[model samples]
Target: MERVEPKTADDAGARADAYAAGPLLNCLIREVAEPRPDQDGRRVYRLPGGGRLLRVRAGRRPAEPEVYAAGGWRRVDHAELVKLVSDELRRHTGRANDELPAEMIDSRETLAALLAARDAATAPDDPYLRSEQCLVTGHPCHPAPKARGGGPAASWLPYAPEAHARFPLALLGVRADAVVEEGDTSALDALGEAPPGYRLLPAHPWQLDLAAPALAAAFADGRLIRLGATRHDVRPTAAIRTVHAPAPGGDVFLKFSLDVRITNDVRRLWRHDLLRLRRTDAAAAAAVAAADGPAAWLSDRGYRTAAFAFEHLAVVVRDGLREHLRPGATALLAAALAEGFDGNPLDALSGPAVWWPAYLRQVAPPALGAFADHGVVLEAHLQNSLIAVDADGMPVQALFRDAEGVKLLPEVSRSAGLLPEVSRSAGWERLVYCLLVNHLCEIAGALTERFPAYDPWPAVRAELARCPLPEIGDLLTSPTLPGKTNLLLRWTGADGAAARYLPLPNPLAGG
Candidate 1:
C-alpha cells in the first residue's frame, strides 16, 4: 500500500473537501435547501428541514461551507458537513440511512487518496484521454460520486481514472465448449491468444480479484484458465468501468462488469441488459448513422464472457472515439467541459456568440431526430455525450455512446396526465429531461458562467425550433421542464433505473 506522507495527507484532505462539496451542495440546493438572494457576494441558502442557514462561496462548485448558528457563522469541514447533511436529510426525508452518510465521508476520503495518487501517476498525452480522466469531481450531482463501495484504498486506487492510472487487462481463457458470447465480439480474439481448446476473454483485474472466490471453482475444474495480462496498458475513462486500449488505425474500448457500486446501483452489466444490448445499440447506431453531418455513435460492438461466470466476467466492446471523431477535431467528455477540466476549451472561448450555438448545433439535432424519426430516446446526458471541438475550441461534432440507457419506442410505455398539472407524456418528458435538463443545462450554464452577457437559452430555443419534430413547439413554449430529482430518488431507495423528476423553470419560456 502506498502511504501518503503527513504533509501530503493534510493537503489532500483540504483539497478533497472542496471537490467533494460540489455534488453535496448541488443536491442540497436541488432538494432540501432553498436558495436565498445573494448575501455579501456569497451564496446563501436556507436549509428548510434542518432550519439552518448555510452560506458558501457561490458559483458552480460551491465551497467554504459555513452554517449560521447562535448568531455566529462557523465553518464546517467535510466530516461535520457530512453530519449536517445526515441531520438535514433525516429531518427532510423523515428517513435515516445508516449506509449513505458513511459513504459520503468515504467519498471525500477517496478523493483525498485519488489526489495523493494522481501526484505520482502520469496522465495520458492524448487530449481525449485527458478529458476522460480529468473528472476529479466525478458526477456533479451525486452525494457520494467517487465512493468505490467504501473499500480499502489499495483495492481501487490503482484503477482510479482520477489518478490517471493505466494498466493491462487480465486475460483469461475459458474452455471453448463453455464460451458464451453474442453480436460482433470477434474483437476480443485479437486481445490475446488462448490455448487450442479455449477462447480469449479479457477481464478487468480489479473485477477478477473481486470475483476470485466465485471463479475459483471454474479454475479448479479447468473450465477457466489464467492467461496473464494483455500486451498494452489500457487507461480508464471517466466511467471507471470502461477503458481505452490503443490499437492500429483506430483504438477499441472495452467496458467491464464490476460488482462494486459507483454513483448508483451495482455497475454490473446485467444479463437482461446484455441480452437486449444488440437491439438497443443498433437503434442508437442507426439513429446517428441516419442523421446528417458530423454526429456519430460510438457503437457497443458486442460482449464476451464465460458461460459459468456470466455477468461476473462479462466485458462489452465499444467503438473508440478515434473511429467516430471528426478529423483534426479533439473529442472531450461533455461533463468535463461542463464542470471545468484541466485544459477546458470553455475557459478559452471568448464568448458564447460562436461557441454556444456551435455546441447546440452539434448536440441537439441528433437527439431530437432520433426521437422523431427513429423512435429512440437516447440518454444524451453529459457523461454519455462527447463533444469534439475544432482547433478554435468550437464544437464541430457530437459523438454519443452507451446503448444500455437508450429507450426504444416499442418498449416505452406512455403514461399521460399522471401528474395533475403536467400534460406531456412520460416518454416525451424523459427525453426532455435527458436531452435538455441533464445534458444542455449544465453546458449552457458553463457557457453563461464564462460569458454572463450572453443568454444561451435563445440559441438553445433556436436550435430546437429548427428541428421539425412536433414536440419542439410545445417544448419551446412549455411552462416547466422535468428535472430528475436524484437526491430524493436515492434517499427513497428507489431503483436506480426508475427515474423520478420534478418541475423546473423552463428556460425556453423566456422567463
Candidate 2:
C-alpha cells in the first residue's frame, strides 16, 4: 500500500490525534464509563465518575469524541480527552496520576513522528517484515501504547519498528570469565567473532546508548570490549527489543534489553525472568509439540550477557520462522492482521464463512489444547502469536513465542501455594484474556469492520465448543470475559506482571 502524506503540520497532528484517541477512548469506555443509548447515530456513554455524558462515532476504532458541557456536546481533541480521562480516573479510582496523562500525550507525539518517518522510509519487501513493522496503533486497549518513556522522538525513531527500521547490532565482547549465559546461545558466536579471551554478545544499539553510563566502568576495566557492528542489517520487530537478522546459514531473532518503557514497563529482560527461561520455554515447547497439527513454538532457545551488566546488556536468541513455519506458508503477525497493513491476507478475503473457521481452526486449537492437556498456559496474545498462511492466504499453522509470559500450572500453583481450583481459575482467567479477549477479539473486530453484518462469534463459539476442556462449557455460558485493565494498572503503578482484569461482555456466550 502507498503511504499517505499529510499536507501540513495541522493535518499530521489531527491524524495523530485520531490515531491516539482510539485506544485511549477504548480504555476509558471499557474501564471507567457506563454505556448509554446511542445518540444521533453515535454511541453514547456516561462517565459516572465525572458525571458527564460522552459520545463518539463508534466502531472497532472509536473516534470524534465529544463530552456534554455547558448545555451541549463539546468536541474533545486528544489533549482534552487525556484531561477528561485523567479527571474521570482520579474520581473513579480515588487515585491521582500525573504520569499517565504525560504518557498519553507522549504516545500521540510518538505517533506523529512515526507517521512522518513511515512516509519518508521505504517499507520492507518481505511480507513478514512488513507485518512485523505495521502496527501504528499498537495494543488497541492500551492507554499509551506508543509512549517511548517520554524520550525525544530522535532518540527512538531510528530503532522504531513502525518506521521500518533495520540496523546492525552493536557487537560487544565480554571477558570469557565474566560471561553469564544459559541454554543454547551458540547462535551468538556466529553473529560476530570474539577475541580468544572474550565471548561475543550482540546488543541492541539503542540499548547500548541507554546503558552507556552504567557500562562505562566495564568498558574501562576491559570486562567489555566493543567489536563494532554486525555485517547484516537486522530488522526491528513489533517488539522493539527483538530483531530479525537474515543470514546465509539460517535466519535468527535476537531479543535484547531495552530500558525504555513501550507499553507498560521498561522492556528489559529481567534477571528473574531470564533465570527461569529454560523451564518456561521447555514446557511451552513440549506443549506445542504434543498438540496435533502444524502449531509451533518459536522457542527462546537461550541467552548470553555480561555478568556485570546482565539485564542491561542481555540478549535472547529466539528460534526463527523458517524452522517452525510450514514449508510454503507465509507467517504474519496476528496483530498486523488486526491492525491492517499492506498485503494483509484478511483484506483479500471475500467472506468470513470459510475463512473465519479455518482461521480459528489453526489459531485456537493449539492454545486451548496446550492449556487443557499439557497444563501450559500460553500467552497467546496477538503480538506473541503468528498465523502462517498458505499460498492462497488461508491460515495453515500458528506459531507462538515469548516464554517470559508462559505459565505452567504446576509450577505456578506450587510457587503461589494456592488451591488447585484457585490456580486453575487464575490460569484460565489469564488464558481467556490473552487468547480470546486480547488476540481473537481484535482479529474478529477487524474482520467485522470489513464485513459489518457478519457476526464472527458463532464460529468462535463453535471452535470453543470443539475443545473438550471443561472450561469451554463455563466460557460459552458466562456473561463476561476478563479484559486486562492496562490503564488502571499503569495508573496505579502496579507491576506489569501483576495483571488486573475487569469483566467485558462475552460475545461467545448465548450465541
Candidate 3:
C-alpha cells in the first residue's frame, strides 16, 4: 500500500484527537463521573475523584471536551485529555498505570496514520470487504482501541484492515512429525503444496515477522521449512488477525495468532483456547442449528500448527459466507453498520421504524434463543456479528463467528472444574454485556443518530419480551445494565479475561 500525506499535520492531529478523545471521554463518564445538568448544549459530568467538572458535546460520539479549571471551563486536546483521565483514574482507583497513558497516545498517533493511509488507499470493490475495513473509530467504548501495540506505523500499516490492505499469505511447510492439528483443516492444504515429508501451513506475514526470533531454532532444524507466498490475496477483516480468503469453490476465513495487543488482550490464538476449540465450536453450532431462525454460525472448523510453535504459528480455518448466506442477501459486519461506511445498507433507509425492527428480529432472537434453549453463550458483540440484508436493505438473517469466545454453561464449569453457579452467572453476564450493552446499544445509537425522533428501546424491549427466557422479565425491569469496564480493567492491570462491569442506567427499564 502507498501513502500520501494528510492535508496538513495540524488537521490530521486535530482529527485524531477528536477520534481518540471520544472513547476516553465515554469511558471516563460511564465508569466514574457523575452526570450533571446540561451546560450550554454540552453535557456536564463531575469527576468525583477530583471534584472537577468536565463537559463534552455529547452524543453517540462525544466531542469538544472541556474541564472546569481555576475560573472557567478550558478546552483539552487528546494529549491533555489523556493526562486528565490518568490523574482522575489514579485518584479514583488509587492505582498507577504508566502503560495505558502511552497506549492512549499511541492510539491517537495510529488513528492519524490510518486517516492518512485510508485517503490514499483504494477501498475493495466487495461491500463485505469494505465493511470489514471501515472501522476507523473502532470499539467506540475502548480507551485505546486503535493502539497497534505501540509499534511504528510502518510495522503494522501494511497489514492494517483500516488501511484497506490485502496481501498474500506467507506459506510454510511443517514437518509431518511436528504437525499437530484437530478437526477439518483441509483448507490449509489447498493454499499451497509442501514437500513429501511436510504439510502445508499458511501464516500471517505480520505474525511470522513477530515470531521470527522464537522460531529461529525451528527454522535452523528440519522442523520448519519456508515455502513461498500464496497466489491469492487475503483481505484482513475487522478482527485484524482473521482474513477473508476467496477460493475457487467457496470463500473461507483464516485466523492466525497475532502477537499484538489489540483492545483488551494480546490477540494470540492461545494453546489452551485451541485445545478446547472443537468442543466450544461444536456446542455453538448445535445451538445455532436448534435456534428458530435463519441465523447461522460460521464454525471454526479446525486449526493447524507445528507443535513446537503452537501458539505462535497456529492458524484456524473458519466457515465462509457463501454456503450459509441466503441468495440475494448481502452479509455485512454489524460493527460496520454501527460505524458508518460507504454503501452501507443502513444509510439507504428513510427511517429506523422498519429497519430497526427487522434488525432486532434477525439479530436478537438467535443470540437470546441460543442462550435460553441451549447452554451455549455467544460472544455476539458487534465485531463477532454479521447482519445479512435483503434487496430493500432490511435485515434478513444474522451470522455470527468466533467460537474461541463462546462459553458453554455447565459444560465449561465441568470441564474447567469451576462452580456451576459461578459459571452460569458469569456466562449470563457476559452474554448480556456483549449482546445488549456492546452490540445492540451501538446499533441503536447509530439509528438514533439518523432518526432523532425514533426511540429504539421500546422495540428492543418488545423483542426481549418475545423471547421465552424467564430472565427477560427481570432484564426488562432492571435498573442497571452491565457495562464492561475496559478503562478500569486496564488501569488495575487485571487479566483481560477477568471482566469487571459497572452498572449503567438501563433504557429498557422505562420501556
Candidate 4:
C-alpha cells in the first residue's frame, strides 16, 4: 500500500485533487456507529455509509481523518471518513514492517531475491532445506506423537521405520531446546557429511511455543537427547519444524495446519453425508463412512498419515501448472468453442473428416454413460480447468481442483429430493452459467491467445460428442434455453431450421 510520499504543498494538493476525482466522490458518510468486538479481540467502529468495513484501533493517538474541504469541524461524508480513519489508524499502528528491498515486489522478484540471499548467507556447499512444524503437538514433524498414538511407527510420524529405511533425515528442524550445551553444531556437521541433499535450517524463534510440550514429553520419556541451548522463541502463526526426506530432485510441498480438518474432496464427502442426516450422531456416522475410502487407501498404500490426525488432508505438490493459470480461463474457452462452431460439426467444417464418426462411435456415448453411471457432474467449463503443456509444449493433461463445485447426481439426493423448497431453478441456472460462460470462456480465450496455430475447437467438439451434450446448432436453433444462464439445451427436430428461444431461471436465484 506504500506510495510515493507527498513531498511539497503542490504534491499534496495534487493528491487531494486526485482523491476527489476517484470513486469515493458520490459516497456519503452517514455516522460513526458504535464500537463492536471482532474476531481478533479488538473493538472496531462500523461507519454507516461505507458498507461493513470495520474501523481499526485508534488508540491514545489523536488520529484525524483527511478532510476533503478545509472545514474545521463539519459533518464528514462516509467515504472521506473512511480515507481519514484508514490513514490515521495506519500511522498510529504500523502494519507488519517486514519490507523487503524496494526491487523485490512481485512474486517472481521476491522468489529470486530470497533464493539469492539465502544462497549467499548459507554454507556455499550445503543444500537448501525448508521445514515446518504443527502447533497442536510440539513434535518437529507434526500430527504429533501424542496425536498419532501408535508412536514412531505411525504413518505420519516423521521418523517412521519406513522413513529411516529409505529417506534419510536430510533437513531437520531441531527443537531449539534439543540443542544443549554440548552444542547442536556437531550434529549438524554429522548430517552435512552424510549426503548431497542433506541440509538443515534453524527453527524460527516461535517454534519453541509449538515444540515445548513435545520436548517435555520427549525429555520425560528419555526420547530427547539433551544438547546445548535447547530453546528459542517462536510466534504462534509463524511456528514450524521441518525434516527433509533424503531424495534427489524432490519438489514436495507439505502443509501443516494447527486445526485438524479433512480438506478438499474428503471434507466434501463428509459434508454431503452430514446434510443427509437429521440427527447429529447419524451425521457423524456418515462422515466416518465417507472417510473410509481415503483412510483405507492410505493404509493399504503405506502413505503415512501424520501422527496427529488432521481433519483436513494436504495433497502432494505436482507440476504446479494451475498455480500460474488465472481463474476464468475455462469459461472463456467454452464460449470461444461455442462461437467457432455454428452448432453442427458437419455444417461448420468444409473438409471431409473421418474422425467425426469415430467421435460419435467411441467418445460421446461412453462419456455420457460415465457421467450418468458415476453421477459425475463434469462441470468442465473453463475456469475449473487448466491447459498445461509438457516440456515439448504439448497439452498433456487437464488438472481439476476445487471439488466443492462438483455436484453429485440428482439420484444421490435425499428422500426429500434436494430439499423441498430448494431453489432448484436458480441453482441450475448458475450451474449453467458457471459451466458455459464463466469457466469455458476464460480457458478458450487463453488457449486461442497462446496457440493461434492450433485450432482447439475440434477437440472441444469431440468432447461434446463424447458426452450427450445437445448439438450446439440444435440448442441455438431451438427456441427455449431452460435455465436463466441459457445453459440448458432443448432439442427440436421437427421444424428443421426455425427453433424458438426461451429462458430458464437460475435455480439458486431468490424468486
Query: What is the Cα-based lDDT of residue 271 in candidate 3?
Result: 88
Clashes per candidate, residues 3 or more apart or on different chains:
0, 0, 0, 80
TM-score of 3: 0.96
lDDT of 4 by residue, 191-288 (tens): 23222332222221222223456446544643333333213211111111212222233222221222211110111112332233222222222322
lDDT of 4 at 430: 42
TM-score of each: 0.93, 0.96, 0.96, 0.30
Which residue pairs in candidate 2 have backbone atoms (N, alpha carbon, C) closer than 3 angstroms, thus clashing? Answer: none
List the global CA lDDT of all models: 0.84, 0.89, 0.90, 0.27
Which wins on TM-score, candidate 1 or candidate 2?
2
lDDT of 1 by residue, 1-511 (tens): 0111233345878788878887888877777788888887888999988689999887666777899999988989888888898889889889988778877888999998998898788878887888898888877778888989888999998898889989999999999999888888877888889999999999999999999999999999999999999999999989899999977677899999999878768899999888878777887798888998789999998888888888999999999877777889999999888756667898776677988888889999998888888777888998999999989888999999999887766532222111122223666788898889888988877777777788888888888999998877888888988977767777777888888887788988953
Worst 10 residues of 4 by lDDT: 294-303
- Supply candidate 3's per-residue lDDT for 19: 79
Off by over 4 Å in 3: 1-10, 411-422
Q: Tens-digit lDDT track for model 2 on 60-108?
A: 7788899988999899889999999999899989999999899999999
Model 1 stretches astray by more than 4 angstroms = 1-10, 411-424
lDDT of 3 by residue, 1-511 (tens): 0011224545777778877888888899889999999989999999998999999988877878899988999998899999999999999999899999999999999999998899899999988899999998898888999999988999899999999999999999999999999999998898989999999999999999999999999999879999999999999999999999987699999999999999899999998889888877887898888878899999999999999999999999999999899999999999998888888886788888888889999998889888888777899999999999888888999999998888878865466443342376788899999999999999988888778888999999989999988888889999999999999999999999889998998999976
